[model samples]
Target: MIPIYKPYMPQNIGVEISEILYSGQLGFGKYGREFENKLQSFIGAEYVLSVSSYNIAMLIVLSTLGLREGDEVIASPVSCLASNQPFAVKGLRVVWVDVNPATGAMCPDDLKSKITKNTKAIFHNHFCGYLGDIESINAICNSFGIPVVDDGIEAFGSQYKGRKLGNLGTDVTVFSFQTVRLPNTIDGGAIVFKDKDLYEKALLIRDYGIDRTIFRSSNGEINPDCDIEVEGYAGLMSELNSYIGTRQMDDINSLLAVQKNNAAIWNDKFTNLDTINSLKITAGCIPNYWVYGTLCKNKTKTIKDFKEQGYYATGVHINNNIYSVFNNNVSLKGVNEFINHFVAVPCGWWFENK
Candidate 1:
């Protein structure tokens, strides 16, 4: 059976990994640094700190920002579990909000309604790589003096009004270089902070609250032995992963072109099929389609049809509504619709043809 998603491994990935295995420098080193630099430069962010996963990135971003217990986080309900857990993990209460159905993004109106006096930050995930209404979202949050952390795991290159989605809408934009991400690092993540002070703070938090090896010597000399572990986890990406990430980063433009073309193909091809629910895009927002998704007239039957047709498709994750733990106290009409109708159609590097 066709699966909903699979990791992309270009021709040289094994060679790169093999080289690292042979190098005796297996931990975080030059590879992770290069990944951090290349990624920051690629996204036009001021500074980037590499970490183990987007989950660690989120937690670090929150903890470094000084968000604490009784602090409330406004999060889009129509997001994956990771988006909310960081807040919960840091002892902050999460305020669930809804996303706009068309864009599959945070609704600014709902955001305005949800912001309370104790709200510390707003978190948004770029669901399915569709761009969020980031400018408006940022505007509202900034007016209320709220920090916004973008969960940009799925949207590596999604842009809003010419600016990338993560960069435009939030103070800290977190990305995952996990296998599921656009530029796969196997398992890694980073937090991009546009502000200098915030960037340093995040760096310290990632390294265990200490500050050393902060940069290469002025003469460009490097020293791994000179180090300090602050209040941090060993969440650095491997150089091998970064090497692959660099390779994938270089290929992103071409890859996105093909994925978007495929999205158009799916939209056009499925138009006549009334039983299909094609994914929607926000006007003027360019999305780097990750898992092209839809809802079926019959969710199960639709997936079965796609599978029968050699397409790997399946339902998606939203809130914990179906989960007994959440019991879902909040009303998330749009999120619930996404949860029920959600089915991801493959749009990665995988091939689909007769």
Candidate 2:
């Protein structure tokens, strides 16, 4: 069977992890700092904070906005639910917006139509590392002065015109270095902020208000109980993970080259299939090819038929509105369409010729 979405933990990782363990700085410290800096430069963001998980990053990004109940956050229902979970948990009403079926991106017109006075912000994902209509998304958000929080988890190297995805028109963008991404890091995520002050606030909020120091020194003596503000979550990524992620970043470009090359091959092959439709991308957009998903001609039985032939195709993501409590509460037409027909074929390691 050709399994889908496998992590390519290279040969050098074992030794590298061993060295980090031996260094005794195995927790979040220098390695995390180094990793964050590298990531900041790579994504062209002002600052990056290494966090425990993308979920934690999601939580912080939502909470930092100071949203309250009844406040609405317009979000594309096409992408992963991790993008919306934070907002939902914060008591903000999630106004589900549909994506353009062609680009799989949130329509700027939809943003204008869906946003009411209660709308606090808009959350849009770069579906398959393809940049959305940033000009209009930016202009609309800026017009209302509401921030745009982009879920760029799948768009690590995606670019628009020339600039990286994270830097384009977003108040902030969240990236995941999970076991499956353009470059997998086993477990890590980051929140990239354009403004230095907002970025530092996120940094403080990430690490229990601890910034650049843990314990204070009184004339060379240790000063205890010199606490800063309310201690936040222990969201710092461990040094071991950071070391792994840092090393992973070094090979990211080459790794994605392979993935994209393979995606082109898959796209060509799927073109001849009368029974399936190949996915499409924006003209100038270069996808990280995150998951390399496609839709089944028949939603219910396509996955089963594919698996019967020893292929590991399945629905790529979950529809949040289907999670028990939401069944009768809201109607998600676009979300339903995506979750049903959308199928993800393995990218990194499943290519027959790779």
Candidate 3:
């Protein structure tokens, strides 16, 4: 059966892992630093921090925002719970924003209508590697003195206009390297910061607010005079994951190319199918097409038909506001429309017509 998603693992990954195991230093060390540097260079970001998972990456970014209880954070309702769960855990109120009907990304007009004095940040998800109108959203947020956090987990290799997703001038951008995502590290993620101060703070926060590098003396000897200034967490990526990630980076471009090619194939085939509507890409935005989603007249029937034909198709993520934990029953017209009809089929590099 064709799965909806499959990770791209390189041929030399086992050898890389063996090296990490034999080195006897397996925590956040040289491999992690190397991976961070490579990712920074790849995405053209000023600073990148490797974290254990995408969820932890989001938590770290939200924690650095200096939000207080009852502070509001604007976010799209049509995203995986991971995108908005950080806000709730940080004691920030979630102000739900609708998504674009065509792209399934945060709608800038809806975002504008939701911003208030209490809005501390605006979190936008680049759904299925398709970028939203982030520039316009950033403009509105900037006017209100609010920062934007991009949940770019599914958009690692995507570009909007000419700029990459992570370096699109957002305040903070987080990406995932989970088992099913592109350039999988088994389980890891990264955070990119536009602000140097926040990047430095994140460096400390990933390792319990303690600067481990400061403990090394000029001669590379251990110095026990370091201090811990702020509260932090054990969010650092492991050396094994980083090593795998570094190798995966070598094939990222090719992997994205194949996925995009497969999505184009589906787009062309479904163009004349009156019962299906493919998700539209915005002008000048080149999507990596993590999963090719379609709005079908009968989503349930379409999913069953696809499954029977050896293709695994399903909803990418449930709308966050539908859960009782969020208790948000407000009408998000676009989101409601999307959730009711959307279904995603396999468009990963491993996918093939059977």
Predictions in order: lDDT: 0.75, 0.74, 0.85
> Which structure is stronger by TM-score: 1 or 3?
3
Top candidate by lDDT: 3
Off by over 4 Å in 3: 215-225
Instruction: For model 3, state the Cα shift of residue 332 in Å.
Output: 1.4
> Ten residues in a row with the worst lDDT in model 2?
321-330
lDDT of 3 by residue, 206-242 (tens): 7788787686789898666887786688898899998
Q: In model 2, what is the error at residue 69, expressed in angstroms?
A: 4.4
RMSD of 3: 2.0
Model 2: CA > 4 A from native = 213-215, 219-231, 272-274, 324-329, 349-354
How do the residues 1-354 of candidate 2 rate in per-residue lDDT, one tens digit apiece?
A: 877767666565777778878987777888788888888788887766779888888877766676676677888767777766776667777777766664577778877988888888788788756677877888998989889887888788887777777877588888887887755668778888877877777877787666546556757554566566633566889988888788877887787777778788778767867567655566666677765767667866878887887778877666565554322235655556656667777666436434
TM-score of each: 0.88, 0.88, 0.94
lDDT measured at residue 319 in model 2 versus the true structure, 0 to 100: 55
